[model samples]
Target: MVIMTATEPATAGTAQTETGTEIETASDAGTAPGPGPGTGSAPGAPAGPVRPVEALLLVDLQSAFVAGGEAVPDAARVLDRSRALLARARAAGALVVHLQNDGAPGTVDEPHTPGWRLHLPVAPGPRETVVRKTGDDGFDGTPLGALLTDAGVEALTLCGVLSEMCVSATARTALARDFRVVLPHDAHATYDVPAAPGIGESVPAALASRAAEWALGDDVEIVARAAEVTFTAARPGCGTGSRAGSRTER
Candidate 1:
């Protein structure tokens, strides 16, 4: 993938791979400090371009979801993709939010517990917003919606743990709230689940992810990978900013 540097051309020519990572560099982005995951200029969103109201929402990437503990199946895969998404989002300077489950006290997700903390791989920066919740829907009774509104985000890119649960709930709520929602196929995941007495002992993680993807339906557009996703940096009144992007979207 070709990264955009401070003095480099940031128009159409630059690009990333299907890995879903964005550009990164301290020289670009004016003053975001050192280079982070996707911390660089945007190709589709050139400097002085009209910005779009979009953001990336990462949900339930808690330590509890990692391997061991209260683990989610295929968690390593989910983490890898999520990290890629996060780097790209940051590189694009897109609004990003990290939602974590504040499980009931004494549970694995209980607040401040070792297992309740965000997994290290998905850690947020000082400027990124972290929204804590006890419910599946990230927007339910949380500051999530308000934060998105404040950031002028009209579209939300969803990724994170337990694709069948929190990811599903948040996508539905985001749609209900009228924000365009995108679920990158490889970006979200869930564990193998126990089946009913008639079914069996376990349901494949891939199967669960597919079910959630289907349940999200047409309302939530699905992309095959993270690199194809992009955020708008410029909106009509938001000044000539850039927006996010995706390979799947027109």
Candidate 2:
């Protein structure tokens, strides 16, 4: 079952990741400093030319879906891949958006609950920010579309949890909007499907992930590994240029 539903205060603080890069909360969006040049090389920067004006969309990598015992079967790999992808994007100065889903009351991801928090640390700033969403589609009622447009994002590399729900729905919309979408095979995951009368036997999470990717159609560039994806900076005047920065999208 795809359980989709799911901010913070102003004056957000920052913490250092293992590598010492400062990570900020979504509340610091727009107000935090933008990335400086000469950060680091992208994950696959040497293997290929840096792609142009691309964004990184991380969907619902919340603790409820990617951490501890309740996590997806492939949660470990998803974390590793998403972390690498995030580092690469930030390093190359790409726009990075983290989508957080709010679950209904009594659910594992109920708003303000421990499980509802994002599992990974976000580097909120001009080019990187978080968007809280209520529906499976990240852009449904959020500022995602406007942010992408304002940043002049022509393509994007997307990764996260619940491959069949949030990931699939968001990707579907990105395609419809004509964004060159790239989904890494190893970066997104989901839980197993229990046996049911209509579906018969249970389906493993890995199979389900593949099925979700296939359903997105050929326009979406599905790659084998997350590392194969490269990155580039968002266009000039991206993060600080519009109303998207000053206001939170509900």
Candidate 3:
């Protein structure tokens, strides 16, 4: 059952405040230093002329969702990728927005619980903005749209959990709002539980991947890897920037 809801504007200045800390503050813990634009090796795959991305949208990377219970395959891997993206966005002077899903009573993401908080391994800069969401869709009953608009974000690079649900749903909504949607394949993760335990026919990753592919369609541009994206200042009268070629894997 799909749930459709009206989109609300995100709170003004929802971006977080910088803690006056340097990028290397937590670099010792397996967090790789992300290369700056024009510094890193280009993605081997050919892509459209690279345009600057104004903002990075981190969808629901909460601890409750990515931990040991109900864990998605390669969740840790995606978290690492996300941390890299966060560093890159900060270095590029782009806005980073983190979304958190607050689960209802008795669910894994219950409020005030450790699981419901943003996961630790993935560190968001103190200045980055974070929004709390109660529903599956981040845009519903939340100020994500407004926040993006306020930040003048023309393109959105999305990564997070539950590809088929919140991630996919928010991507569709972003496209409908005329925002350029870029889905980094390896940047997001999800878990699929079979109806029956021993059925031996469950392929959650494939299903989630397909759902993301289908929902995005032409409205969204699928990026093979985060390293391939280039962010720049938005040019006037350009009606947002352009993205190269179709989606390819890293």
Q: Estimate each model's TM-score.
A: 0.69, 0.75, 0.70
Model 2 RMSD in angstroms: 12.2
lDDT of 1 at 170: 91
For residues 1-250, write the lDDT of model 3, one tens digit per residue.
1111111224332222122222211110012112223323333333344455777778878776677756677688778878888778877767777776767898877756666666633344543567777776777877676666656667878888888888888888877677777766677878764666667666667565656555555456655566656565433333332222322322
Model 1 Cα shift for residue 22 (angstroms): 27
Worst 10 residues of 2 by lDDT: 1-10
- Candidate 2's residue-wise lDDT over 21-134, tens digit each? 445533212011111123233322222332343799999888888878899998889899999999889999889998877778999877667778778887678888877777
How well does candidate 1 score on lDDT at residue 68?
A: 78
Error of 3 at 215 (Å): 2.8
TM-score of 3: 0.70
> Which is the winner by TM-score between candidate 1 and candidate 2?
2
Q: Over 4 Å off in model 3, which ranges?
A: 1-49, 120-127, 196-200, 233-250
lDDT per residue for candidate 1 within 1-250, as digits (tens), equals 1111222230111111123222220110011112222425343332232123368888887777875756776777778877877777777777777776778889987766666766634333433566667688887867676566666666768888788899999989877666677776677888788778977878788888877776764556555555456675323233111222321322
Which model scores highest in TM-score? Answer: 2
